[model samples]
Target: MTKFRPCIDLHAGQVKQIVGGTLDSSTDALKTNHVSLEPAGHFARLYRDHDLRAGTLSCWGPRTTRPPLRRWPPGQGACRSGAGSTTGTPGFTSYLFPEGKFSQERLDAVLHSLDGDKQKLVIDLSCRRRGEDRWFVAMNKWQTITDMEVNQETIKQLEPYCSEFLIHAADNEGLQKGIDETLVQRLAEWCSIPVTYAGGGRHLEDLDLVAKLSGGKVDLTIGSALDCFGGSGVKFDDCVAWNNKS
Candidate 1:
C-alpha cells in the first residue's frame, strides 16, 4: 500500500523546503519555498505522535551551524542523515562522499564495507531528465549530472547492495506541479525493494494517483505540499487519516 512518508529538511541550521534545482554552491542561487520557525525536534515528535515511520531528516547544506542529530528528540523514526560526508566514509556508509561523482572504486569500498549487510544502506538516485526521454542522476546538491542512467539495469545491479532507494525528480522538485508520473511509473517497474518518490506532489489525490500508478508498490513523500510545511495543497491530518484507513 502507498503511504505518506514525511520529511524535515534542514538547510544551514534551519528547517526549510527548497526547490531542488535551485540549490547549488552559491547561496544566491537557492530558491526556498518554506522556512519553519519550529526546530527539527518539533516535527520529529509530531511524526512520532502520528506513528509515521521511515521519515527522513535530511541536511541540505553545510552543517557547520547545524545542531547535532543527537540533540533532536528520539522517536523521529529511523533517520537517514546525508550531510557531512566530505572528509571520509560516513559512519552510516550509505551516502557517497563528494556528493554524486561516480567512482567505481569508491562504490566498491562502500559495498565491501557493508560486508553483504545491504539493509543498512539506502541509495539516493535522485535525477533529472535530459536528451530525449532519459533520466540521469544529479549530484553535488543537484548541480551536476552524472553519467549513470536511472534505469532497470542500474536498479537491478544496485538492488542487492542497498535495501531501499530514495529518488527525487530534480527538475520538478519543490514546484508543486504534481509528480512526474512517468518517473514514478518507471521506478515501480524497475525497483524490487521499497522505493520512496519525492518531488512535485501538490494534493492529497496525488497519494491516490501514486498508488494507482504504481499499484501501491511505491510510497510517496510530500514535502512542500503538506500544510505543516507551509504548503496549502494538503492537510497533514488528512494524510494521517488516509494512512489510518482500514
Candidate 2:
C-alpha cells in the first residue's frame, strides 16, 4: 500500500528541513526550510504514539556537530547520521567507493560483510535530473553526480546488495512545490523491493497522487510541508489517519 512514512532530518543536533540542492559546504549557500526546537526524542515519541513504523531518523550534520548516541544522562539524545564534504576538492569522484584498484575486491568485501544480513543495508538513490527525462544518481551529500543513471537496470543490479531504496528528488526536496511524478512512476515500475520517495510534498492529496501513480506500491515521505515541521499544507494528525486507513 502507498503509505506516508515519517522522517526526522537532524542538522547540528536539531531537526530541520533543508533544500536538497544547496547541501554543499558553503553555509551561505545552504537554504533551510524549517528548524524545529524539539529534540529527536520528541518526534520519536510522537511516531510511537501514532504507531508509525519504518520512520527514518537522518542526521545531516558534520561529525563534530552530531548529537551523541549515549543515553546515560536522561535528557541526552542519540542520533547517528551520514555526513560528507565536497568543498575545495577537485574531481571528488576519486573518492567514489570501489572505484580504484581492486574495486571488485572492495565491493566483494562489503557484500561479504553483509552476506548473512544484507537486509540491514538500505541504499539511498537520491538523484538529480539531467536532460528532460534523465535522472542520475548523486553522491557525497548529493554534491557529486556519478555516471550511474537511475533506471530499472540500475535498480535491478543494486537490488541484491540492499533490502530497500530511499530516493529523494534533489531538485524537488524541501521546495514544497510537488513530487517528481515521473520519477515516482519509474521507481514503481522498476523497484520490486520496498521504496520510499521523498521531496516536494505539499498537501495531503499527494498521498493520493502517489497511490494512483505508483498503484499503491511506492510510499511517500513529506518533510517540509508537514504541519509539525512548521508548514501549513498537511497536518501531522491527518497523516497518521491516512496511515491508519491505509
Candidate 3:
C-alpha cells in the first residue's frame, strides 16, 4: 500500500513544515509555526497515533545547538553533566546530525534519545547545500571528506543503522523543473534498501517517471507544486489517490 509519509523539517532548532520549493536562499525566507515547538518526537508520536508508517524526521543545515533533553526540574542539575548534558532536551530536538558524521558520540546521543525499538526506525540522511538543487554535500568536515559524491562505500556504512534512505538531488530539489534520472537509477542499484527520491517534481507524471526509472522500487517526495505546499496547480488529494491506486 502507498502510505502517507509526513515530514517535520527542523531548522535552527525550529519545527517547520514547509513547501520544499519555497525554501528561501536566505534565512529570511523561512516560515515558522508557533505550535510546533514540541520537536520531532512529538510529531513522531502523533504519526504513531495515526498509525502512519514510513515517515521521516529530516534535519537540515548544521547541528549547532545542543541535543534536546526531557524537561528537567530546576536546580536538580539533571542535564548539567554526563550524557544528560550531551543529549538534547527530549520532546524538543530530534537528534539529527546535519554533517552526517555518524560518529560514536553522535550515534550514542541519538540512540540514547530514541524512545522505541531502534531496529525498526529509518533515519533520513536528507541534506543539501542552501540555494542549490540535485547535489548532496557531506554534512561533516572530516579530513578525509572530498566532494558531493554519493558512493557505494558510504551507503554500505550507513545500511546497518538505517532501513531506508531519503536523498534529494539538491541541484534539482524544489525547482520542479525535472527529475534526476541518473541519481535515482544509481541509488536504486547501489543500495539494497528501499530509497525515496525527492526533488524537481512539478507534476503527477513525475511520480510515474520515478517509478519507471527506478524499476518500480523508488518512492518520491512532492513539494512546491503540491496544493498543500501553497501551490495551486497540483491537488494533494489527487496524488494520494494516485498512490492508492498504483
Clashes of each: 0, 0, 18
Each prediction's TM-score versus the true structure: 0.88, 0.84, 0.60
User: Can you write out model 1's per-residue Cα lDDT over 187-241, one digit (the tens) per residue?
Assistant: 9999999988988999999999999999998998899988899999999999999
- Whichever of 2 and 3 has more lDDT, that candidate is 2
Candidate 3 lands at a TM-score of: 0.60
lDDT of 2 by residue, 1-246 (tens): 999988878776678899999877787888998889898778877776676766555655564243443332342222212223121211111233333211334434444655635555556667899998889877666777777788998889778766677787989989999999999999999999988898999999999999999999999999999989999999999999999898
**Model 2 misplaced regions, further than 4 Å:** 64-108
Cα shift from native, residue 56, model 3 (Å): 3.2
Question: Against the unseen true structure, what C-alpha lDDT does each candidate score?
Answer: 0.77, 0.73, 0.51
**Candidate number that wins on TM-score, 1 or 3:** 1
- Candidate 1's C-alpha runs over 4 A off are 64-77, 82-101, 112-115
Which one wins by lDDT: 1 or 2?
Answer: 1
Instruction: Please report the candidate that would top lDDT against the real structure.
Output: 1
